[model samples]
Target: MNAELFLAPFLTGLGLAILLPLLGCYLRLRDEWLAALAYSHVAAAGALLALVGGLPPALGGIAAAGLAGAGKRLFARRLSGGASYALLLLGGWAVAVLLAANQPMAERLGHALFDGQLYFAGDAALWQVALGVPLALLLLRAMSRHLLLAHTYPDFFRIRGLRSWPTQTGFDLLAALVLALATMSLGVMGAFALVFVPTWLAFRRAARWRAGLLGALGIGVLAYVVAFGLALWLDQPFGPVLAGLLVLVGLLVA
Candidate 1:
């Protein structure tokens, strides 16, 4: 086995383990976990389009998702509660499947699109992880007070005229960008697990937001290492292997 097989996934996992947990911690705290997953699927469809269209997959995906996210405020207003996001999630997924189903060549990208082609992650993917992880962390630290207030006092926030809508939109778009880039490494479902599972565990286990963030990062890294080892040992698919481990960890931690 080429060492790069392990090396690429390890680095991708490390980046996600750091970046996603910070976003997840905030999403978990704010009750917007579903929103992240919803846009990630949209990004996945965008990635698939990129694959078929011969564009840069991550960039194309990010652009498509950002456009959709920008309009989310208006779209969400038309639907009751959070159901609009559900629409986006389903739309993205269905379109991806439909497009892939028509093209015989889609199989080439399918393995990475659904199950994770972490081994094949290119230099572009690596760079995204390298740069994105730190930026995500910085975003979290800078917005701690604002995030705390928004989640804790949403109604009060509106009353205070705090100008949180732009901030909220910016965060939403940023999350879309990260997820789109992460999909280049982890694939769609693997990215979803990375985005949601550890944060779920952290939210349940830790008492404070900061503790939850730290605990989630710890859980994500541990799970990534363990799952990669198990996949290599068993010659199993990395995405499913890691996802199962994450699910089990979420259960155990809960």
Candidate 2:
């Protein structure tokens, strides 16, 4: 009965769930989906680093995120956005895989990246709560309006002549960061539902961005609650349970 263990991961996932879409919303406001692109790869690198390199590695991963963000901006102006993202994704994946293979406690690192066992409700990690919660809240506050705008109305933003690309870029960075943290806390597979499920529900039901976001948020929260319960009852992995709940929600709502 490790209470801290469960509490830690739950807090981490909750914080991440709130922060990621907020970041995406902000980036969309800036018309920079590419920013999100760079963040994804960078965050992946960061997660790998955190697992293997500890503090230094984690810092390096965060730094890589910034560098990648800048690179995406520069390349977007000069090259096709998809091409640039593809190159960066490949490069990032190569580096991350190499790091995972070489890092001194590689087994621990692998578990950190892939195992959902560490993040269940009853046995949460300390760092997940101590560090992740506050960071997520701060970022959410900083990017609030931009997120709402970006996710809700890109067309109106353009009509106003506001630069949505930069906003979107910022969102991408935040999304990656949150997703990275969540992955580290919950496992990579677990992160999938957080990104896709709510959005899917929104798409299936709502016509407006507001309605959609609301739908997603509601479904997201409900899915988490149900999935957590189901996992406990079945003695199964929480991530898959949560993901399944999302699928069910989509089916019922859609």
Candidate 3:
């Protein structure tokens, strides 16, 4: 058994649970529900490079995520939010499928990239999440107010002697980086759980914008504990097990 197994899982789970919901706060308000999923698909496509070319998939994820973020900013100018996100999501999935098809390790890569190999993730992944999570939190904290104004009131923000585009772009970059790091640790599918469930739950319950943030944080932590324990007891795949827990949480919240 890997000596760091317990630490690795805990850190990845905790780091993602905290950071992603914070990003989700902005994403939901900004109406970018599909943006995270699109970037994760890009990460999935990039991770497939690990099987075919033996490349560091994280680089692929970083590149793809950056590009998707850029695409959103650029395309949002002309297209509706739903349309632009639809294009990006379709394009990203196409890339993922193409990459998966080119690889011989299709099933293995599929499982590992799409669902995750979090249980088997080692020290490098743990360190990646450890560093990236705090950096993302700090970056978002610094930019959160600016982000709110820019996305929600672009003209007002710009009129206040602020160029909102630059700030929005900065958010896209930070969000992309966070998603890339998360995809590496949790797999693309699992990222959906970490990013959306807590935010949705928080927003649904809270009266004030920030009221349920802490509650969402608590829910995130509990979700991980429950899912992790259940997976262990059931001897099941951890990623799918967590995904199921998220869906159940979503239902219970509803």
Candidate 4:
């Protein structure tokens, strides 16, 4: 395999390997990690819809997940115990399947979305990650303190007569957009794995919040690089290879 062929894809995945785990730390802190899976699924559905409508799949995905993120507050009030996320996941899955079944072109893209097309990711994906990762980091850094307070001390804002909705809502939108971009490159379950596994291991092993963030980033990057190499050498799908490596790491850590 030519190294140049995969360089762009590698860099794109690497960016998400860093960014997703960082966001995962916050999602884990808030006990809202399920949002990753929900957003990815919805993004997949949106991409399929876009394919059918002759639009850019990434734009549709980001728009759909952004909407989902913005509406999270309303969903929280109407549904409890993460029910809203579950509904989104199932609904998205159903829509994606139906769209793919009805359109031959959509079927091919849908398979790519489900299994991951990282190796096929082009200049567009590279540019997306190039711009997105830094912006996301800046935003997260600015909101880090408020996020911590919002999650760890839910009543702190209330006591101070401050509304926490803005902070929470902003984070939700950020997560959705990031996950949508990731889903376009990494596939639904692959993006979710990055968000779930690294943070989970860090949560178990790290002694401090800062340490946990570092640990998750380290774990995600290491696994992603290794999986990328192994998949390229072994002629396997990147998504499953990455997920398997993470699970193996989890078992070893356990």
Candidate 5:
């Protein structure tokens, strides 16, 4: 695969994994409406990227978007706190299984499910990164204020006549749609781990949002660079190498 395809995903993953949670953490603390809105934007971006880039990268993007939607619909609207997150978690597992069963989409889906040399197969990978990065950056900038509001005062937003339930409902639906499209590309693991791990680390270790973002980005870049070298050194598949790097970083820091 060309450098862009291999490099871009890693870079994009760094931005996304940390950004989503930071947004979530902020939203959880404040305006649920805005949080839901930011979440919606993420889903839209995923779908757009999936369509523009291809199938494999899209899968992961779409799945990440789907998680937000599932969270709002099946969990957030009816439950609170841990219960909502748990339900969404379960739904994610189920979605993954279903996605796996589609034989026609196996090659594309495999990239999401396993850590093999999935996306590292062609020149198309470069386009995947090129398309995803700008989209991610746009999402971050566009939703910045809204995300801040949503994470900091969710209940306050409801009280102020925001009609959070419907907003969340719409948010979930949009996210799911986007995720469906994105799943065609980067797959699930790339989508989920990239979005979660780095963000989690930044939150646990960094003192500020900027610090966390930088840290996560660094981790993402490092993980990919190391994975690339290791893959070459050991003559292993690229996907697993990248996946392993992510896991190793999490373990070392955790």
Candidate 6:
């Protein structure tokens, strides 16, 4: 294993190992865990479309997911809870498949989006994670209290005659952007697994909110490091290896 070649990708995954699980804590709190998968699917469709247009796939994915997050309120008005997220996921999947079938370039990008190309992640991905993670953390910190209040006490804002749309929409956009970056780096299912499994485990075991967040972050990073090394040693795909490891961990913890 060449350290020079693997370092950037390792760091990229590590950054997501931290960021995704933290966001997952919030998603689990809100009972909107499905949003991670939905955003990743939309990002996949956007990446495929970008490939067809000869644009940067990551950029397109971020843009598309961001749009979906921005429009989440509208979707919520028509369909509440997991239904809206399901709609986005199905719509995104269909568009991605159709685009991939029509374009050879898109087909290749689609495979990368689904299966992940984490081993090939370069300086670009590292930089994206480095810059994006801190910004996301800051945004999340600013919105943390509001999010907690909104989820724990649904009518906290309404009782005060305050609108929560800004906080909700802002968090949605943040989640979309972060998930797009994760999907581009870790693949759709890989990103979703990172956001889902660790948080689920932490929520089950931790007695307090802060403990849950830290536990989720710990679980994610540990699983990612193990998966990264195992994937390399066994010459396996990183995404499946990571997802599989998380599932096994979940079972053990359960």
Where model 1 places Cα greater than 4 Å from the true spot, the runs are 159-161
Tens-digit lDDT track of model 5 for 119-198: 44344544544565456455555555544455568677667765554344543444344333323333434444444556
Candidate 3 lowest-lDDT run of ten: 1-10
Candidate 6 vs. truth: CA RMSD? 1.1
For each candidate, give its TM-score against the true structure: 0.92, 0.70, 0.91, 0.97, 0.59, 0.97
lDDT of 1 by residue, 1-254 (tens): 78865676678777886787678777767677787767777887887788789886677778878877777777666775778678888998887788778866555665567887676766667777888778867876877787788777889878988888656887777777777777667777777787789888877768876788888888888887888788788987777888999988777767
Off by over 4 Å in 5: 1-75, 79-112, 121-125, 155-186
Which tens-of-lDDT digit does each residue in 72-124 have in candidate 2?
65667666646666676667666666776787565455544554543543333
Error of 1 at 160 (Å): 4.4
lDDT of 4 by residue, 125-193 (tens): 999999999999999988888888877787876797766765788998999999999999999988999
Instruction: Sort all candidates by TM-score, best to worst.
Output: 4, 6, 1, 3, 2, 5
Per-model C-alpha lDDT, please? 0.77, 0.58, 0.75, 0.92, 0.49, 0.92
Residue 201 lDDT, candidate 2, scale 0-100: 54
TM-score of model 2 (CA atoms): 0.70
Backbone clash count for every predicted candidate, in the order shown: 0, 21, 0, 0, 41, 0
Model 6 stretches with alpha carbons more than 4 Å out: 161-163
**Model 6 C-alpha lDDT per residue in residues 122-234, reported as the tens digit of each score:** 99989999999999999988888888987778787679765787578988899999999999989999999999999999999899889999999999999999999999999
Clashes of 1: 0
Candidate 3 structure quality by residue, lDDT tens digits, 113-159: 67766776777777888888888788877877887788778889878
Error of 5 at 92 (Å): 5.9
